[model samples]
Target chain A: MMTAIDQSEHHAALENARREFRDQLIDADLLVPSGIAGLYGRGAVFEDIIDGIDRVVQRAGSAAHGSGIRRLRFPPVFPRDSFEKTDYIASFPNLTGAISTFEGDNKKHRALLGDRDAGLGWDHHLTPAGTMLVSAACHPSYSGLTGTLAQDGTTMDIYGYCFRHEPAIDPARMQAFRMHEFVRVGTPEQAQQHRDSWVPRGLQVLEDLGLSAAPVAANDPFFGRVGKMLAANQLEESLKTELVVRLYDDLDEGTAVVSCNCHRDHFGVTFDIKTEDGEPAHSACVGFGMERIALAMLRTHGLDVARWPARVVAVLEG
Target chain B: MMTAIDQSEHHAALENARREFRDQLIDADLLVPSGIAGLYGRGAVFEDIIDGIDRVVQRAGSAAHGSGIRRLRFPPVFPRDSFEKTDYIASFPNLTGAISTFEGDNKKHRALLGDRDAGLGWDHHLTPAGTMLVSAACHPSYSGLTGTLAQDGTTMDIYGYCFRHEPAIDPARMQAFRMHEFVRVGTPEQAQQHRDSWVPRGLQVLEDLGLSAAPVAANDPFFGRVGKMLAANQLEESLKTELVVRLYDDLDEGTAVVSCNCHRDHFGVTFDIKTEDGEPAHSACVGFGMERIALAMLRTHGLDVARWPARVVAVLEG
Candidate 1:
């Protein structure tokens, strides 16, 4: 049996891996530490690389014809009620970020200002702002499709900044990050086909950008003891797959830069989404973590974009 | 004298204006409210408009020669210490959003999860995550430039999503919005010239986009009675100018879509930034509020982008 000690050891190994990658990024001047554990300031070159990768990923998505894909953009912070309906709080309570503000009267505000001026913590005065930072790009997309779906189904391309509370030294895992997701709501077979087709396409997109990547079965980072069992069940059912790339030449393992997941009626049931035939619509999404892909490119091809391969340059520029 | 009664009346009028704009946006399906005041999900058409405006603004920025402008992008959140150094807490304490998480042990975690599952507020367990959501795009840019500047000066183009706590039904006043800012650091005169030149260029950019924009003196939305005096002083000094456009056919007043600001020596003093000549480096910036510009375009030239003037379409497309 995997004991608590085993979990501790596993966590320590992950921390070391994160530190190694962080050191290399810092050396390259690609990342400037924000004095926060999981947050960092990316320089101009890094920003350019991210922009190039995003463009290519967007182009790759354009090949999905006949699906009538609608593009949507959302703010990182979401309505608290909308978030609660997704059941993310019950599943991953620790990773959620709630928006709050100081809701005190004038006299209390004066004291709050004084505390800030005196370098005393002023967070105690913060009241809930009736919103929560988004944990996934597809949450709002799924919520938006609540009532019913057409017989032919619907597709959406969404991009947004997402937040999580898992603060770490890993350059790969950010507290706040960007996610580009293509979501489809349809029949079970249709949803499965949508994700499966994207698996090879996702890998090819990275390959075109000059990064070596592969798809492997994966599981969500569920929390605690019961979460361990849930994760095992997910892996057993093969519900998730990741497109991973080696972050460093010396590292034996690869980082998951893109994820393809089939939620299979879970969201439809939760959001009360039904097909025109009166059946629960199954959902699937292919998500590319933009920053991770950029990091992977930097790691595989080196930090200098000018020295990058010709094909990569052509794909990004063209 | 502006009494409490006057403040209440002013707020009521602002609320009415916000509702009018909100109703118009809803009718156009350009905005889907997130059930949170000042937050909305943007559709593809709205996204396209925003993208067009951003591209044109970037091209307009390219006209600055010899400035050697560097482009930078930052994540939405910044280090808490770096955020505190900006002294936003001392001024606008209520408008800041600090990132926090539920940092509790497994036993406490179970209780936290239970509370969330039971529909009890889970935010009480969230501890500070050591970072805060950004209030301005230029804050990180200025923080990154702390230390010394060359005698020739430094120029930077920054774009990022910024957050504020003000919540209303106003379609224009988003809690989370994108800001495109061009910043300069040099001697006072050089910084002043950078801002002054941008005023006409900003107006022209809007004019080319078929929106009649005029640069009018403006002030920041400072807080409280002391802030009112500060705003008056800023307006008197001509430190800020805004490109305004009419939001409604019924209203004569126009909204500020863009702002040109001269922050002479303020950031230098705050961040200890110095020039090669050992004098405090003055700073100035021209910021284009991306959503506001898109909204202005939608309001001024109907919702149909195809029907826009030939010159406007050419500039956006070309």
Candidate 2:
């Protein structure tokens, strides 16, 4: 489970490994070729990664539909009403990033506003949207798709920057990273077909780039008692698995390159996403961890980036 | 200086060109090829562009001084005190992005915390850290350099994701973009010399990739009565000029592929950025818009990213 604070040495070790892995990516040219030599913030990298991830998904959708895909991008911040209906905080209480603002006198605002940088203190900041941090790209996509679910199943490949407070860091798991989830809403068959099609195509793309990627059963990082229950449900129903690769011989922090989740009727019932027959539509999605992929490619490939094979470079460039 | 918002049909056309340019880049195999397409915010493309631009500048710095250049990467969000001394809000009053919070009543908090999605509104968020949205990457770098100038002359290359309130839809002029500013601090001569070196190098980069670029004097987009005076002053002093290129023959928005600015002790006086000789240091920076370059590359090369010249592909892959 993700925690707000920690002193666990085991968890600390995992975080160190994650940090080392991040450095390795920079060293490998998959990350900043310049190296991670200075201070950087989670917010900054999160923002950038989110942007890049979104771009790839958008281009992919455009390519698949040639302008037929309706684009709907939501604000990073959303109202609480949306999440309440979805039961996000309740389902994963500990996992939700909930924030509230401080109310102060007008004098406080003036003091802050008068001096470009005054001591307004952390508490003076405004209340943040409840559970604003998107845990998954699909959350926002679902919000955007609430009343727009097509009976024939609409396909949306979206990008979003998501955040989580994990005590440990794995090259496969990031505190913040870009998540590219391709969501499909329709009859169970249609959704499954969409989900399954990606595996082969994704593998083919990897193969073309000279990567040896394999699909595997996996469970997402859920939280507390409810999270465990959610995972159990997913496992019993065979709902999710992520594609993994070992960036290093140490399995302690091997990376997760792709996450494929076949959400059965969970979302259908939640948002009333139904099919032509008015049955709750089944939804499934394929998520690609762009940073992880780049890290994997670099770990598998070479650091100088100049050394990437011509063919592989061609594929990536394309 | 950044403006809150502005929109024109011309802006929309530029946005279209930007989209087309991104598409072309995907086709050229120059990038993994994302547009604002993916599930996340499309801002990743903007971030990637900024990073790419920084890489070019970093490479240039390395070439100039093999390992002597101290590469420093700073946090995007800094302590509010830093901005106060710099007078950023006053100078770029309209452009700064401030983070504020709203504090809710106990009843409201209980109601919000109880609901899954319905949570605190923005009105109750906390007072923002005295931060203006960063209009340019140089602002933070300059602020850091204050009170620590190398009298003899010091050249430092820094990169950061910058934000601005540019309501214009021109892809080239985005609300946020990555800026790679190769900054030089020293005597007037040293600052000017640093700016001069990039002229040939930047052009060579374009030529090597088979693109034509031109250099032109430029003016900052300032607003209000005082802004007009500032703009006039800048013109009189010849402070800003951008290396531009026509992305499309039909589009009026040419890419500002590169920009070189000579701040003649303006920052030195403000932040007390001094030199080793015990005098204030003048500073100058050469900036490259990473996204615009990719756009330029798309225009110069074909969009079938796979077919981009092997040399360029090698650089990107590296």
List the per-model TM-score of the A chain.
0.90, 0.75
- Candidate 1 regions with alpha-carbon error over 4 angstroms: A1-29, A249-252, B1-21, B65-67, B249-252
TM-score of each: 0.92, 0.57
User: Which candidate leads in lDDT?
Assistant: 1
Cα lDDT tens digits for candidate 1, A1-318: 769998788777777877977887867768877666787777778877877888888888888743478888998887778887777765676887877887676678888787876878878888887777889998876767778787788888899999888888878889888999999898898899988989998999998988889899999987777778978998998999999997744344678999999998888888889988889899999999999998888777777778988888788776
B255-279 in candidate 1: lDDT tens per residue?
8889999988988888889998888
Give candidate 2's chain B TM-score: 0.77
For model 2 the local lDDT of residue A1 reads: 65
For residue B63, give model 1's deviation from the true position in Å. 0.3
Show the lowest summed lDDT stretch of 10 residues, model 1 chain A.
A246-255
Top model by DockQ, which number? 1
Give the lDDT of residue A154 in candidate 1.
89
TM-score of the second chain in candidate 1: 0.91
In model 2, which regions exceed 4 Å deviation? A1-110, A113-152, A159-176, A200-216, A223-225, A248-253, A263-282, A302-318, B1-112, B115-318
